[model samples]
Structure formats: C-alpha cells, structure tokens
Target: MTERIRHDGIVVVGAGLAGLTAALAAAPARVLVLTEAPLNAGCSSAWAQGGMAAALSPDDAPELHAADTVAAGAGLVNAAMARLLAEEGPAAVRALADLGAPFDRTESGAFAQSLEAAHGKARVARVKGDQAGRAIMEAVSVAVLAAPHVQVRTGAKLTGLLQEESGRIRGVLALIDGRPVEITARAVVLATGGVGGLYAITTTPAELKGEGLGLAALAGARIADPEFVQFHPTAIDIARDPAPLATEALRGEGAVLVNADGERFMDRYHPAGELAPRDVVARAIHAEREAGRGAFLDAREAAGKHFPDEFPTVFAACLSGGVDPRKQPIPVTPACHYHMGGIATDADGATSLPGLFAAGECASTGVHGANRLASNSLLEAAVFGARAGRAAATQNDAKGPFTAVTAAELPPVALQALREAMSRDAGVIRDAAGLTRLLDLIDALEAAHGRSAPLVAARLVAACALARRESRGGHFRADFPGRAEPVRTVVTLPALERPGLRFAAE
Candidate 1:
C-alpha cells in the first residue's frame, strides 16, 4: 500500500553510531532516524569490541595517530582529512563521554587507554575492555531517544532514494515492516554499515548486506574502492556460520596467536608479531588454516582471570560455543569484517549526488584507504557523522512533490545463491579466474533478478575486484602477488555501461 510522506529537516538511515551522531548533530532542527532492526540488534557498531582510538594519553599525540592511520591506509589517505580527524579525535571521544558513555578510566580518574595492533601508543579508549561497542551504542541510543528534535523509527528499512527532477536527492522510500512508505526530507544520510553480511562466514549481522551501497548506486552515486573487504583474523570458528569475533584488544593486552602445536607463529609473518596490522594478521591466519596448521588465540596466559570483566562479549560468545576463554585457546578463522570501499564521499561526507551524505562504513571516507585500523571505525563515525549532519542541516529547500516508485524484493533462492557466490568467489582470497567467474555470476544473477539492489552491490564489489589486479590490504590476489602502481578504483554506473566495463581515469 502507498502512503504519502511528511518532510523533516533531515533523514538519517541506519541508527548505529554514525546515524545517531548525525541526528544528534542536527538537533534542534527536526530529524527523522530509521533503523532496519532494533537499535542494538543488527548494527556492526554494537558488535565492535575493540574501542575508539584517540591520542588521549600523555605519551601520545594527534600526529602519532595520523601517522599510524596513514601507515595503515597504505599511502591512500587524504592528508588533510586524516589530519583533521586525528587531531580532533580526542574531542570527539570527549563529546561521547559527555553524552554519558561509560569509558574505562585509570586509577587517577583519567581516561584509560589500550594498545591495539599497528598503533605505536596506548591510544584506544575502550569500555570494560571489550564492551566498547555495546556500551557506547547504548549511551548514544539513550541520547537519541532523549533528544527532543530527533524522532527515531525502528524496523524501517530504507529501500531507495527519491530524487528531484533536477537529480538532487529529495528523500527516501522505506518499508516499515510490510508496509511501504515514502518520506521526504531536506537531506538524507546513509549510515547503513558495511558489506560483510554478503559473505557466508562474516561477523556482521546477516541483514546488513551492502543495501545502502546498492541503494546509493541504483540512485546514481559514485562508488569507490569497492574491492577492499577486511577480514578479521580471530572470528571463533566453532563450526558456526557468520562466526563470532574475538576482539584484537585481547592480543593488544598481551594474548598470543599460536598454531595447534603451541608455537608462536606471528613472528614468522611480520616483525610486529602479535601486533601486526589487521590485514597482515588476517592473511597469516588464512594461510595457517589453509596449510592445515590450525590456529587459535591463546589468551589464557594474559586474560585468564580477567575474561568476564575485561571482555564480556568474547567471554560469553566463547562460553556459548563451548570454549572457556580462561582455560582453552579460542579456535579462530578469518571472516569478512569490514569494507574499505563504499559510496564515495568527500571529506565532509558529501556524495557525488547533492543532498545525500554518508558516514560510517557505508561511505568510503578515504580515512581507511586499503584497510581500517583497529578502532578507527568508531572514530570516523562520530567525527564525519557530525560533519555530515552539520553540513546537511544548513542546506534546506522546498521541492515540488511527485509520485514515488516502489522497491522490489528478491526471491529466497536467488538471495541464497547471491550470498553463496560472494562467499565462495569474492571472499578473502582473490584470483583472476575467481573474480572473473564472480562477475559473470553476478551478470547471470542480475539477468534473472533485474539487478535488484543487493545484486547491484555484489556486482560492484566483484567488478572492482576484477579490475584491481594487485594484492593490497584486504584484497589479496594469488595471480597478482605484488602491489602494482596504486590507483583508486572509482566507478560510476553510467561508466560501467561502456564497452569492456572500464572506468575512465580521472
């Protein structure tokens, strides 16, 4: 059934940290926020365990943070943007603290920080060791609910963008439960998280399968770096699909990665050993598993007595899976965790299409170039989410109304096939043959499903992976073992329709 819409000052989709932060930033100006699931249930933000990183400690500085970010990004981060976010990261953490996030503190009542892999300092500010995501999301959720100007609509899924005759985004078409509704807003922000749900063995919620990227693409926005998907090395592999994550913070606190033979294996992979960057760790874990060495995180030496308080999430997940963290090594396997590429955005979170901004994992903010640093995802959400909100709130317009088109749904079997194809072909490892087969499979799926929103996103990732021939970050290619000349893969839907599916170099 068709329901007409009401306009708001801003519309923010996906009520994770980014969407809620945007809503809070736009406050006093009426805002509407939508979430596909209950606020705490589906978002990757709540699933995050490692904590937010900021140069808050006495020994650390923003410059150090920027340098680490640049190092992790592999020379692709925008210098100005990285500097701005890193310099301001402490304040962002403070703002969240002011909003009542219960961060762990030192004995002196100062903010406590932990060291994560790839960082040179103890800059990660966590909550109860591993409850950072849950605690922070809960705090923000309370703030959003209490905000007088922010109205949150739960169980509302954004299906597509509504545009003006001039091609500016007007608002969104959403499905609330089974009923379809169109809501017009002066501005729309997409914060629908990452593309991990597209894979078979992922840590992200099954429902969040790059729908925002798909919707944005179908609405004609430019996409960037669609090939790079980060796999976390320590997803507990107890015969579970969409495995549980054992946060890297455990190792940061001194846990070691070992093979079945009780050998410390990370030393052979990188100089950083247990503290290498995530991509390196994930690749190491993948290689170990592929070689039948059997890998696990042995946190017992460090976290035996502190498991419950330090890492409630990991402790409980392990308990449920019949592995006791205090006595046993948690079985681990690499699983898709984050996507470095997404709806392309400028530093201010503005997409190619005006009036639509994206933050969090849904937008490729370029802060995370080839891969994301351990806890930087949450930082990017708050900093850029606020930026996007402030930028969008200042720009308001009155547009004429028009009829809205409805969103299409994919069949059950087709959806399963798409997931299986992504998990098998476009997963952690890539090769020319696999990626090419993935593209062709996507083509066949689209021929049947008419390039439905999800399939469009899947195809974009595969096509981009097929084009980028070199192994870098989360995208490792056996065919192209070395890093070739680094160039960002940028694609526009119109450009893809050209012969050979080639994107013109800018």
Candidate 2:
C-alpha cells in the first residue's frame, strides 16, 4: 500500500541534538522529524558524557576556548568557525537550560564546570557529573513533543535523496516498516550521526553506519576532509560490539594510562602525559597495545571514592562488566569515536546541494578541523543544528509531485566484510598500502553487491585517506610520516569514483 500526503512543512532527517534543536528553532513553522531509532535511542548525542564545552566560568573566556580548539585541531581548523562556536556556545548551553535541562550548578547558582582534555580552563558544563547528554536530550525531546509545529516519526530510516533534473533537492525516500514512502519536503536537514560503525571497535552507536553521509554524497553533495576520524583512547575494552567510553574527564582529573607492566606510558610519548590531545593519546595507546604490552586506564587515584557519584554512567558500565574502577585498572583500547569529515557545509550549515543542509556529525562545518576538541561535539550540534534548522525553515517550496523510492538494504555478509576492511585499512593508524587495500575492497564490494550506504561512506573515507599524505591530527598516515602543508581536501563523488582512478595525494 502506498500513502501520499503533501505538506508545506520542513523535513528533518535526524532526531538527535542537531535535528531536535533545528526543529525547535524553526518555531511556528511546521516540521516533520524522522528517525530510525526511537527519539533518544541510537543517537551519539545521548551517549555523550563529557558534557558541552563553553566559556561559562568567570576565569574562562571564548577566546581561550577557541585557541585550545584551534591548537587541538592540528592546523586545519578554520579560525573564524572556532571563534563562532566558542562565542555562541554559552548561549546554546543557556538555551538548553531554559528548555529544562538540569545542568549541575554551584551553590551560588553558576554552572558547575569540570575540566576536559585540550581545554585551557574548567569550562565543560556537566549534569550530575556524566548525565549531561541524557539530561539535555531528555529536555529537548520533551520540548519537541510539546511544540505544535513539530511532528516526529520514529523507525523511519532514510534510504535516498530525491532530486530534480536541475540538481535541486526535491524530497527524501525512506523505509518505514518494510514499506517505501516518499515525502516531498521543502527543506531537508541531514543530522545523522558519524560513521563509527564502519570500524570493528567503536564507541558510537553500531546502527549508525554512515547512512546520512553516504546518501548525501550519492546525491552529489561535496565531501570534505573525509579522512579525519577521531579515535577515543579509552573505550572500555569489555566484550561489547560498540564499546562504552571512559570519558576524557577522567584523564583531566588525573587518571593515568599504564601498560601491563604497571608503567605509566603516556609521559614518555608526550609531556602532557594523560592530558595530551586525543589523537596523540589514541596513537600512544595503539602503539602500546600493538607492542604486546596491554594498555589500561588506572582511574583508582582520580575520583576513586567518588567514581559512582562523579561519573555514574562510567561507573555503572564498569561494574556491569565485572570491573570496579575504584580499585582495578580498567582495560582500554583506541576505538573509532568521532568523524571530523563529512558532507561539506558552509558556516550556516548549508551544503553544496541546494535545499539540503547538514549539521552535527554528518556535516563538516570546519569547526573541527582534524581532531575535535573534547566535549565540542554537543556544542557544535546545539549551535549549528539551530542554524541548519532556521535556514531550512526559511526555504518554502515543494517539488512537483513524484513517487518516493524505497531504500535498499545491504546484505549482512557484505556489510561485515566492509566493516572488517575499514577497521584494518582506514583505522587509527594507517599507511598508503592499507588505505589502497581498503579502497580495492570497497570497489570489489560495490561491484559485487551494488552500492550500499556503508560502502559509499567507507569509500569516501578510504579514498580521502589515500589522498592525504600526512600524519596530522586524527588522520595519521605512517607512510607519509610527517605533517606537510595544511591544505584542505575537497572532493566530489564523480572525482572519487573516476573509472580508472589511480588514487594519488593532492
């Protein structure tokens, strides 16, 4: 059975912080929000524990926050964007608080802040220590439900983009309960999360297989800096598919990374020890684990007695996995955590494609250049998601009537193969041969099983990784051992998929 309904409302493709914020910001304009998971489930936004970074303290300032962001980004960060995010971040935090988010507060009613890695001061605003994301999302979800202009539909996954022959976005095709439905939308926002599921070990939701990024790219949107994927150094090494994160705040609180010999190893790699940039920490852990010396995070001294209260989420996850953080050293590994590259967008979250805007993890706003500063993900979502939503809401035009196509599902075997290849080739530590091998495998999979969303996204990452010949930030190439000139990588689908494309660095 086919159902056709036309409305002048905007269509928001994700239900995370960005999508929800966009929907709220659109105000009285009608919005139709679609999500594959239930409102708060399967989104990286809800799993965040480090809280949002903002210059809310009296001693802190936006300029300092922006400086730390630029430094951690490893030279590719746009100075203006960093400054914008830092300056506007406190407002976003306040807005979330006004919407009923229960952020932790001091006795004097100021935001109770905690320090995170890379930040110059105590600026990360938390909620009961580690409940910031859950609390904020819960508040936003409630606001969205009460808003008369926003209508939400869970379990509806985006399949493809509908476009006019003139190259303008017309609508979106999605899969709803095993059936295909097309919605003619005036403006579409892609807030779908990152491509962490592409890796074997990740701290992101396993269901987020880069569908949003792939769909946008397949529709011919420009992609930028696809190689920069941040690997969290302390994913709890429990036997979980998508590992649970041991928040970076632990390191800032004095947690030390020690190998099997009970040796504190990070001091030898960088002077900052446990507080170095994420990419540096991840590589250090990777090197330790690879050398047969298993790595562990001993949080016994840092917030030891207060573990349960300080970071309830981490404490619960650890106890459930049969390790108590107050005593035992928690096993840790570097896992895919965040993607710094995605469907390239402008300052206002407008993508290269007309009528399509992207925000959050799916869009590369250049706020995060190579490695993202700690706790910046939530800030970016709140700030830019509103921009994308407001921009999309202003666009009011429905495409001439057309049938919506159903999204194709990728086979399990093919999906598994692709994930393995990505973990092996385009992972935390990479080389030219591994990246090329990953590309060859992607080509083989696409040729055999057709173009799956995950494969398309994987190809973009591997292709870009192959082209970048530097060990900068999250994208560390052992073959090209040093950081060269910091020119950004911008590529189109056609350029990447060229028929005889012998991939070469730009």
Candidate 3:
C-alpha cells in the first residue's frame, strides 16, 4: 500500500548545497527536504575539493568573471545567465561565510583565493585547502538543521514525480524505510545532483544516477545540452570506486603533468601547459595514457611538505594508495566529474513546467554550456540555489488530479555493466561508432530491465552525443573533429521519441 500525505508548501528533492540552500532560502514557507543519504554524505557538493569561484579581489570584477565563464564554456554559454551568476557569486560566497563556512582568510581579513584552470584571476575561495566542500557543507547542514521552517527527511530515495494531467509537478513519491510514500505539495524542486555515477570511473557518489532528471523527462520537461559532460583531468587512479580528485588548484600552484618517462607533456598539447582548460588537459592526459606513457601529476616540487596541511584530502588519498605526494608523482586519469546539461531552467531556477523548479547540477541554467570552468560548480549551486528557493516559496498551493510516474529499478549487475559501457563509449573521447554501440546497449538493457532512471539518463547522454557530430568543449568526436555552428540541444521526451530527430540549435 502507498501512503499519501499533503504538504501545504514546497518539496525539495536532494539535500546537497542546492536543495538545502533552497530549503533555507524558502523562509517562512514550510519546505520538506528529502535525500537518499544522510546530510552531506552521498552528495558531490561535500566531495568538492576546489571550492567556489567568485570575484572577491579588488582588481577583479564580475564582468571579467562572466567573460571567463563564457570563454570556458566553449561557445554555448548563456551570456546573460553567466553575467547573473558572476554578479551574484560574491554575495553567495559571503552569505555562506556568514553562515560559518570558515573560508580561508588572508591576514587582512579578506578571502584567501587561488587561481584555477580557465579563470583569468585568482578568485577561487577555498577552505583548509581541499576541505572546502566538507567544511562548507558542514556549515550549511548546521544552518539547515537550525532553520525553523525546514524539515529534512534523510534515507528517503526519490522514485517518481507526481504530476497532473496538465503537466504540473505537484510533489514526489519517495521510498522511506522500504515503503512507498506519496508526498504532494504546492511545488516541487529538483536539485538531485549530476549523473556521474553512470560512468565506471567517477568522482561523484555512487547513489547519484540521475533519477531526478529521468523522472522529470518522463514527466515531460525540457532537457538542455544533455551531451556535455566534463571529465576531470586528474582523478587519482588508485583503483578506488569513486576516484579521489587531485584538485586543479594543485596545478594553479605550479604542479606539472608528466608521463612515466618523466617528460612534461602538457606543453605539447596547449600553450598554457598545466593551466589549460579542463577538456584540453583531459584529452592530453587521455592521449598520454593511451600511448602507454601513463600520465601523472608531479606535485612534489609544488607542495612537497606543505601537502599534508595544504591538501590533507589529497594527501590522505595518496597515502591510502601507498603513494606520498611529497616525494612521488600521483597517477591520474580522466574521470566523470560534472554534467554541463540537465533539466533546462531559467535564471530563477524555474523549469518549463509550471510548478517544477531545478537548481544545482541537476538544472541547466545555461551557465555551464559545454565544459564547466574549474570551481564554478559550487558557485552555481549556491547562487541559483537561493534563487530557486525564494522563487518556489512565492507559489500558492494548487489542487489538481495527478498521476504518479514511478521509474523501474535496474539491478546491480546490470547497472555495473551500464557503467562500464558508459565510461568506454561515451567518456572523454567519443565517436559515432562508440555512441551507436552505447545506444544499442541501452536499448537492450531497457528491453530487459524496463526503463530505469539510470538507463534513461545514460540513453540521453549517448543519444545526444551521437547526434552531435562536432568536437566542442567536453564533447569530442574523432570522426568529426571540427566545430559546427554553436547551437544548444533542447529536448523533451516527445521530441526524442520522434524517429530520426536531430537536435536543432535553439
């Protein structure tokens, strides 16, 4: 039997920086926050090592930040949205600091910032080096727990979205303690993170398989740019399931990329060497590894003894793999990091559906068009998260007859197979043959296991990637190695259903 409940306010799915921020920002309006794991456990926000990007220095301005963001996105970034994110980013970081985020501070009481890959200035505000994500999440978790109008229900996994015949999302149907519970509310917000878990090698939590995105699409919402997935160039290759990241800040601090022959190779790929954009660096490392040279991040000269205190997270990970960063080069590989596409949303986080709002990695606000700039993930989550929260709080409760669309679950073995396939075919470098094979595999899996969320998300990535024939940003095709006219991929379930549908530029 399914249990039903009615909430007279907004329901937020996901408990990461975005969802919690939304819950916090929706002041005086009752907000119910649901998550599959305990606060800060399974979400990528807590695992973020590079911290948030914002223009905090006197010489830097939001205009510069926006320009850099647009340049890094590889021609598909929404300029207006990038401008908004940059203009509001400083305030968002400051707000988190006020909530006791404990950002690293300079002696002059200003934010201690660091330089990252594509940014023109040193503006990434970090904490205790690689502890930025954990520290900031700890502070946000504390604040959310203390908020009067926020109710957090952990161990609740979202299975379906409740929508009316008119396509209005009412709430979510989640599984709590192995029982199905339908919680209908005035509005529904999806901030369920990204689809990294779909890949065999990923830096995100294993539980994040894009259920929110699949459910939204199944319930008929517009998805944008589902093909642009950023692969981080330096995930520590220590045979871990969810690979530990060697943050880009290490390169900004003068770390170099070397091969097994101890030859610095990034200079051959790009002029900026280790400071090149993520896609270029990732491809260089991939090529090196493919050539049997085996890429490595030689940070020994950069951090050395300061590694323990400066990047405790990376230090511990290296130690776990029997490698010391102070004396040795860390083995690195490109791993699934961030998704630059998701449920299409406006600046305020409102999706095409009337009552469905999205924020964080799950929402594509045209900020991260193709490849995400280093450290901007956290900033987008904070800035747009608050916007979605406040905007959702303004909606008045609506009553309507709706149907609950529940997704099928993929078994463990099948999911592992799917993951391996994704990493092989649709990963850092993709081509028509690989993508077509991947889609065929998805079809077989869907035929066997029904249309699971992970399968849907994987299909979306593969199909769109196969359709997009040009090499641009994070998406590269060996067969078609040139850029086509810059166009955004706007898709809905109905549009995707049409046979031979090519994504037209919006």
Candidate 4:
C-alpha cells in the first residue's frame, strides 16, 4: 500500500538554487521542499562555474543587458521577457549577496564583474572567480534551512504528477525510501533543473534526466522550444561522466582556443574569436575535433600562476585529469550545458495547467529564446524562482477527484543507450537523418520499457528537432544550413501523437 500525506501548502520539487529561492520566497505560507538527493547534491546549480549575469556595473544598463540577451538568442528572443529579466536581475544578485553569497568586490566595495561571451559590457558578478554557483547555493541553502515555514525532505524522487480530471495539478507522487508516497498540496512548483543527463556528455548532474519535464508533458502541460539546447564549448575533455567545465571567464581574461598543433583556431571561426557566442564556438570546436586536429583551451597566458586562487574549481578539475592549466593547454570538448526549452510558463512561472508552476532550467519562460546568454542562467533562476514561489503561495487547494499520472522507469542499460543516441544525433549539430535515427531508438526503448520519463524527454527533443528544418542558435542543421523564418516550437504530447506533424509554431 502507498503512503499518503496531506500538506496545506506548496510543494516545491528540486533542491537547487531555484527550489531553495522559491522556498525562501514562499514564507509565511508553508512549503514542503522535496529532492531526490541530499541538499547541495545532484544539482546543476552547485556545479555552475559562471556567475549570474546582471547590469551591476556603473557603465552598464538594463537596456544593454536586455539587448545582449536578445542578440545571443538569435532572433527568436521574446523582447519583453528579456527586458523584464534584465530589469530585475540586479536586485536579484544583490539579494543573494545580502544572504551571504560573498560576491567578489572591487576595492571601492562595489560588486566586481567579468565580461563573458556576447555581453557588450562586463556585468557578470562572480564569487572567488568561478565559485559563484557553489557560494550562492550555500548561502541560499542556509537561509532555507533556517526559514520557519519551509520543510525540506531529501531522498524523495518525483515519479508522477497528481492532477484533477480538469487538468489542475494538485500534488506529486514521489518514491521515498523505496516506497511510493503521495503528497498532496495546494500548489506544486517544478524547479527540477535541465535535460542534460539525456546526453552522454554534459556539464550538469547526471541525475537530471528531465523527469519533471516529461511528467509535466504527460500531464498535458504545454512545452516550449523543445529543440533548442545549449552546448558549452569548453567542458574540460577529461573522460569524466558529466564533464567538468572550464568557465567562460578564462576567455574573458584573454584565454584563446587552439588546435593540437598549437595553432590558434577561433580567428578562423568568428571575429570575436575566443569570445564568440556559445553556438559558434561549440561548432568551431566540434569541427576541429572531427577534423582530427583536436581542440584545446590555451589559458596558460591568461591565468598561469594565479590559477589556484582565481579558478580553484577548474584548477582542481584539471589537476585530477592529469593536466595543469598553468603549464598545459586544457583539452576541451562541447558538452550538453543547458536546456533552453522546457515546460512553457509565463513571466511569473505559472504554466498552462492550473495549480502548477515551473522555474529554473526546467521551465521555459521565454527569457532564453533559442540560445541563452552566458551566465544569465543563474540570474533567471533567482528572479523567476522567487516569482513562482510568491505566485504559488496564493493558490488554494482544489477540491475534486483527480487521477495520478505515473511513468515506467527506463532500465540503466536502456538509459545509457538513449544517452549515447542523444549525444550522437541531437547534439551540438543536428540533421534529419540523425534525428530520425534518434527517434527510432526512442521508439524502440519506449516499446520495451514503456513510456519512461527520459524516453519522453528524448522524444520531445528529437521529434521537435526533426520538425524544425533551419539552422539557428544551438540547434544547427547541416541539411538546412541557413536560417528560415524565426518561429518558436510549442508542443504537447497529444500534438506529437502523429508522426511528421509539425508543432504549433508561435
């Protein structure tokens, strides 16, 4: 028999930055936070190296930040959403600092900022160089643990969404201590990070296989931009699962990309060289690796002796991989870094389904249109997370008969197969043939393992990627090499029932 519990408050799934932020903001109203792993583990927020992006510098303005965000999104960005994120970003960063994030400060006591890929101005507020995510999450975790109205429950893995017959989500079905536990609440907030684990090589926690997104889709929630996924160009090329990252700050500080022969290669790819948009740089590195020249990030001249103090995280990762950044050019590769698409939501994190909300990388709020601006992810998480929390606090429990929606679990072997297929086909560069093969694999896996969450998420990415025939942003197609009309792909499971059916383009 399954255990059932009722909580007269909001249920927040995930324990990352967004989840904790939402929990903190939903104060006075009781909040039950659930996580598959212990706090600060199995979360991408803690692994993030790049700091949050905001217009905190005197020379920078919110307008400029918004403009850069739109430019990086490559024509599909929602202008209003970008502007809203930019306008609210500064305060969000300052708020985290107030919570004891310990952001690097200038001699005059102002927040020190760094220049990343597409930003025209230096505006990324960091912590001890590349320790932004860890430090910020530490501070937020402390606050959430101390908050009176918040109750955190670890070792609870979300398995399904409990929704009313009217499609109103009322709670979640989770697996706790190897038993099925149903927890019903007034509102459910999904901040379950990204789909990086669906790929073989990623810069995110391997446990983040997009179960939240898949369960949401199965529960009839709308999904947006399912084809756009960002691949960071400089994930350290050690043979590590969920690859370690070499933050873009190194490039900002004058690092360069080079081939195996010690030849600089970025100049041949883009005018910005080491600082090109993520998509461009990823493609460049991919092309180099495919050509057998090999790709590397030459940061010897950039940090050199200051490597230990400036980038301790990266320095440790390199050392573990038997490569010293001070003496050797770090081998690099493109890996799944962030998902630019997910359960579609509005500016306030409210999804189409009533009583349900999403934030963080798992929710596509249109701030990141096709490709995300560098370092903007953390900012979006903090900004929209609080918004979602505040909004969910006002929701009252629905009184109606509801059905529990659950999915089968994909076996480890099948999941590994799926991950390999995703990395090979729907990865940095995609085309029709590869995408079709990927879909076929997903179909086979589903036929054998039932409609598992990972398979559903993988199908969403492949099907939508196959439907969209243009090369733009992170989704580059070799067959359709040029950009066509700019349109956002919006989908639901019902609409994807028919093969070759193009999703509703917004």
- Global Cα RMSD, each model: 1.5, 1.5, 0.8, 0.8
Please give the CA lDDT of all the candidate structures: 0.86, 0.89, 0.94, 0.94
C-alpha lDDT (0 to 100) for residue 215 of candidate 1: 83
Off by over 4 Å in 3: none
Residue lDDT tens for model 2, 1-506: 65555658788999899999999988778999989999889999999999999999889999999999999999999899999999999999999999999999999999998888878898999887888888999999999999999999888988878787556787787777768787778888999999998888999998889999988888888998888999999999998888989999888888899999999999898988898999999999999999999999999988899999998999998998999999999999999999999999988889998889999999999989999999999999999999888998889695564433233467888888888888888888899889888888888887887888888889889988888878899999988879888877888778887776755444
**Candidates' TM-scores?**
0.97, 0.97, 0.99, 0.99
lDDT of each residue in 384-413, candidate 3, tens digit only: 999999999999887889998888999999
TM-score for model 2?
0.97
- Record all residue pairs in model 3 with backbone atoms less than 3 Å apart, i.e. clashing: none
Candidate 4 Cα errors over 4 Å, as ranges: none
With a 3 Å backbone cut-off (N, CA, C), the pairs that clash in candidate 4 are: none
Model 3 lowest lDDT segment of ten? 497-506
Candidate 3 lDDT at 357 equals: 100
Residue 418, model 4, lDDT: 94
